[model samples]
Target: MHQPTKPTNPIEKYFSVINLYHYYFFFILFLSKVPVFWHFLSLIFLSPPMDFYCNNTLLIAANESHKNFCPCEDPWWDKSLFTETVQTKFDLYCDKKWIVSFTQSVLYTGTLIGSIFFGILSDKYGRRFACTAAVALLAISGCSLSLMPNITSFIIMRCIEGISAGGYIVAGFVFVVEHCGPNNREIVSALYHVPFNLGHISLAGVSYLLRNCDHFQIAISIPVAVFVTIRCLTMESPKWLMDQGQTEKAAVVMEKISKFNRKPHGSFKEEIEEYTAKRSVRSGHMHFIEIFKHRRLLLNLCCMSAIYFVCGIGFYGVSQYIGQMSRDIHKNIAISGILLVPASISAIFLLKILCRRTLLMITTFLSGVFMITVVFIPAHLTLLRVIFACICDCFFFMAFITAFLFGVELFPTSVRSSALGFLSLMSRFGQIVAPPLNSLPEFVTGLTFGILAICGAALCYPLPETKNIDLPSSLEDTKTLNKKNTLGDLEKPMDGQSTDIDKPDTSKKT
Candidate 1:
């Protein structure tokens, strides 16, 4: 058999060169998430309390007459090892306990709104535009947090911080996933979580570095806050450009992709033109409504929504246990946070061996088992309980990563951000449910994990699989999934066209 002759264009020749620049922006955006969860974690390590014994004499005199819980003359919780917190600044303890929960609730409320707002922005305005704007929002809100004067101001800032984080996360995730080739999608998608774990670790480290709560907030906020401007330097996804009928910009981005990767120039222009010409006008203008018009799309979205809901609350529920446990909260969080390194590595290796369907089932099933087992351990066996609980959380974390990658692989470029945003919104709601569920154990010891276990087991089964397969590039492609079929077209590039990039590349990197 005769092989087709190679194209003579130097650009085409360059196509055979090794590709490299695909992930630069991915890493940049990944680093931006460094501060997203720190404030929440700070609550665990930094909350302050006044020195007051709840004696009847003190209580009656304080309430009936003219004294505060702690005498203004007596100040406490200012030890060398630990710093003051908003809880202490406002004296939000005992009867004021609801305030802490209320603060977090407002944050989630911001996230809910951000997810919807930014998801639409990603689908409509463009990834680069939306992500850049969100970066600004998140950074500004985070920086302003340490400056807030009253609890009302603090809670209001937290809500702003949540909204900003909401936009950053969804747009950043969508941007990175869109910019990469198929070979690295799982690693890149799962890579988002690594920074989250890092954020927790760094929050722990910085909490130690800056002893004062206000300074600690500045320390954590400043690191990521500085990088917000970097988003302005990043490029939009070529695939997103193409989906929106901006073929000219898409061509420019593809050229940049080739340059960054140091691949020899190839015929990216002709290939994009051919693909775009064949695409229908309706494909250019995608609506969120369009995502569910097809049966397969509807079924897949519904199942994915359910899984996000369960996994969202479930992951938080497990983590909160370790937080609430009688042992060292910092050590337990550090150790648990470190577990993500292994969980991420396990995901990277296992993704290559097991089909996505098999892996999703196995991880969720095991996570469920571990979650359930946490309930049966004798309370006297505290060490054993902690270990079991940590393992349960590790697996849930793994499952959560798996779901992130799977969701990216499931949707097409035009609507991928919207789909993921919808999932994130549901996840937030589940997270909203988690704190309340954690409270439920006060009434019933096993309530939270028991519910999560059932959810972990039941919710992961409905979605179609995409293990080691090509992703769909359009609604038409996604709509074609048969309930019984795996996503077999995983090798297809985002635009659904064969390009010189697919040809053999014996050339070494320049």
Candidate 2:
């Protein structure tokens, strides 16, 4: 590989030259999180449509209360008539509410598949290409679901959107972290949720504005179109490029990034050369199975996966059912949306102050404690329940956001996406089981959430703290700190051999 010459400008020495454009890059990549916001919104829209189908049955029953045996009145209610229409096909086995839950589960199932397949594919290709392709699929499939003529078609479309969404989320997070410098990485990563919260607000607003099905579909489709347009101009990660041995191309992208920030073109060549020199000796071709070859890496992945799964179930179980919670308290969806702002803001600030491990453990434990009290709160004291739920919501949001950043930090660049993909796969499995669990008795839901929280707390104890630690550049680095209590010792080797347990001088590495 030909190395480009270093820039002569003294001003280019600092990495901050590219900081100005960081937010712009962040926003474009973070826009992908909108699908998560849409997933929640879709649940809101989806349930009602199913209700419209099944609610008719309830109305029919109410009208025929006095009759000895009430016959089906309308063709829509007739078993045979239902068999002919789109709604009738799924109406036979389940009520609309169950159908909604089933479809959402189907979406998660597609996500599980997509995360594994495209997560690996993103590594093989480039992050930008893989993510952009996922966005295109999202726009097409999401729009198609809105226009679906029948129940069968709607289910299929939801599955397609889910699969694409799975790929997009994994790729988006990897792309953002790869571009960020070490000090600012956690903050930038947490900002991923800000747009998602805005999207949730948009969903609530849209639902309130267009309560009817037709208008709701149009409202959701608009953002999908916007995402596709934004992704077209998005840049590939320079880190990923360097990993693939394309240092010159990485430098060109860095130069463009400097230009985009309205800063003078800095020494991209110098930075690339420096970064390449530090590249881990480990090759990029390491398979997924190798993630476990090192015990510490294996333990780290397990802990992260368990935390992710519990958080996924608890978070989605509570969040997806918020509409029901709102109705239970006689509040509107807009109020629910407004209430989410605090949690999102708290997440942004909390991530900055706390290390990834401590923050996640504390929040997860607290959220579970709060949830156990939810059912016991008196119905007459509506204010107490709402306040308690809001607190729980805050913890849930904080824990969820922390896990995402924590998971990214745990893996080396070699299998970063693949490790995340596997974690995502487990999370999807949690999502798959949550809906049915929600149908359990109130006591059961609280108990399950409590168990989830406790599990998350336990998992946090085993994870190596990554606060202020540079991301591991190779598999050897990953193993060096596998059982170490402090990250300080892993910076450099004391002897020529890999075994270096003593603290090294940090000033030397740079």
Candidate 3:
């Protein structure tokens, strides 16, 4: 609410100030996630064997001394290409292939542990500390994958990467949103996906050119390693600093940001003044336990957990099976990642028009429809499946982005990052289950899709809509939330008429 400080120097009056801190903000924020991006890449670049046939040429050339007949039982994969995938390194093909799924589960188990661990760390030590540790850990374990001696080692390394990923990703998302004014909040929240989509697209192109998982691992790992010093460069969130009652430190952090962004030093003064002035109501400290105090918040947590889990499954499930959709694995993966750019941008506008609850429900349901349909398209129809699968990913991405921002809006900032960490823990739990569920489609065609669809419908209606009001800062700030239906809030905002920062909160009205 406060404007940046005006320049006292006479020469400064003639030149215009351009806010440049946003670029650096995104740079470090996004770069910190390089290793986490590998979560998707490993699956694609290290694709498991879905098809197998004897090397027909070997069979054709066999002399009379050997049985020349083609053997389907232990068929070698036809026309496979890739220097290394975790799957290939350990001979995890045919019958022993469940090992691939188990490795994925192991990675998520680390993520699960990391979510809880780093969450408490971020809350206790600060976002900067938690984020830096997560990134550094990610770089170390991720690059180590290239040197794995056996499947056991690979599994251990993957789990470590998962743990670190949980912290960095959660810390980064919360940090960016916490930096913004109300006008910038929604867009910044949605745009958080840009970095990941950029990573996803780059992953496709780089993997295409690199042609080996070992190189790919090292390629993505080194940047985070290189940028490890960013922790020193960045400051703790001023909002968090304020909540902790360190007003002077929070003000200093805000001033540094204002100088970089070229905003008047007064730019952050209003928020700081308001927080200090209204300390009792706005700066109430929240721990993980407070997250479950209200019935509405608790239900939201549960529904959102299920919804996020389904999206996680859809995300990894569709990605792993993209090869099944088309002959060109590279082409499909490229398209899938590329689609995220427009999908993310589109969500920004849709959130304004549709409200958060409807949009998530509709998009998720549509994604489910696409997934179920993908299964029935007859495996041989490659082009059609490709078309349908890409469409599913688009909707899934839309829902995923919405649900992410939705979770942020539903909680007070006191516990926002920790709340997200808890959600991350649940989502990773879903990811843990995802690898095994990947095998489910093989046994029961279209089954996974149906389950996701049911989850979308059941989970979408119970969560409160946040589009019409200011973000909550305390549990007291969210007391009215439990009284409103998740869907009813769309018609009548829980915060009294879906007001903006400029409007007064009318929750006490009637």
Candidate 4:
């Protein structure tokens, strides 16, 4: 007599279906990334550091000695291009120049808090709830920026927006990737950033047309408002639903997807039940601390944190200062944004040829080299400086895409959002400190990002490659990551093929 074979992951089986919901949801999620870029990169245009001269008669003696008269309470701003900005409105020049940096730093600080808060929220609740809540807050806070009467109120609104942006970033990413199968995961994840880059490109045009920071704020917030209204059309991650033991709900979602794909709805209850029975017994839900319980998981987190710190500082620091690189700030911003499109699009193809680790290492190291090259260029050649800076930023952007994709695959489903949130927090910390670097000498800022990028590239060596491997389901699975034989075996499976380790062999001799 022959033994019966058990069902494999029923949810994963649906992952390969190119369905209507998949296209619709992917578009919605990709669109979500646009607001994030708009919010984060808005500071460059909103608080643009314009040339200013102190008009205070009391500072006549001080002004005579200083070539660049600034740091005064009241200054006459050069508003030929921009009529009003945070720098001009708040008198964030001369003595108050540090406050200019504070605007960017404070926004990142909000993102820092959001990372931890929403990370936990996603894990405890669901990705859908966390995403919707975060975007709603983003919409409200962003629109409120135009109404802020004082700098304090403006800072508060920016912080709130940052928190929401951070949450949307991690949650939205997890939501999209979880819906994809290994076959399309890398490509889908990489293409997600295309809209984000488009946001970057469009911001320059928007900022050029709307010079007032208030109008720019209102304009950018409108899309997020539209997103909040349509968020209901999207569904929660079935992988997350299954992980939480809500197999019935997961099966329902899978059936909906099947129907949208124009395929006959098949029952998934038996497969889901079989897969759930094989999982380790659980008491309550998994917490963020669960990653610390395992050595490999902890190491992976630490390594990613260190690299994320560099990426955060390197990318944001450069972006914050890129406007100052040339006389035509608008042109520089637009060009930098344009370069990211190709860099982001290239990653989709690169992932097919190279493993995750190799691609990251190459991009990060080159980012450092290009940044350092910018420092050596003569100031007379502003065009060269802008070109080099844009190229360097492009490489840094690729590093960011690789990091997000790599980190998602590094941890288990139970704590994936939590781990990513922590990494994002570290990155935000890097962003917080980045603005201050602008006050330093040009070489110092360049050298800081350059050294950090090189160090980050080195850190990538110890981490295991996740290309074509199944996402870990539990803490125990992460422990085997460091073992040579385990990774060696997992890498053998062809792209899109199921790893035997994840699926139990139910067929045996009777």
Candidate lDDT values, in order: 0.68, 0.68, 0.68, 0.80
lDDT of 2 at 319: 64
The number of the candidate with the highest TM-score is 4
What are the per-residue Cα lDDT tens digits for candidate 3 across 242-294?
Answer: 66666677778867876776665664555565546743465446777866776
Clashing residue pairs found in predicted model 4? 70-94, 71-94, 71-95
Q: How close is candidate 2 to the true structure, as a TM-score?
A: 0.82
Candidate 2 colliding pairs: none
lDDT of 1 at 315: 81
The TM-score-based order of candidates, best leading, equals: 4, 1, 2, 3
Q: Of 1 and 2, which scores higher on TM-score?
A: 1
The predicted structure with the larger TM-score, 3 or 4, is 4
- Model 2 lowest lDDT segment of ten: 3-12
Q: After superposition, how far is residue 418 of candidate 3 from its true place, in Å?
A: 1.9
- What would the TM-scores of all predictions be? 0.85, 0.82, 0.81, 0.88
What global local distance difference test value does model 3 have?
A: 0.68
lDDT of candidate model 2 versus the reference: 0.68
- Per residue, candidate 1 scores C-alpha lDDT tens digits across 108-164 of 888888887898898888888888888777778777988888899998888988887
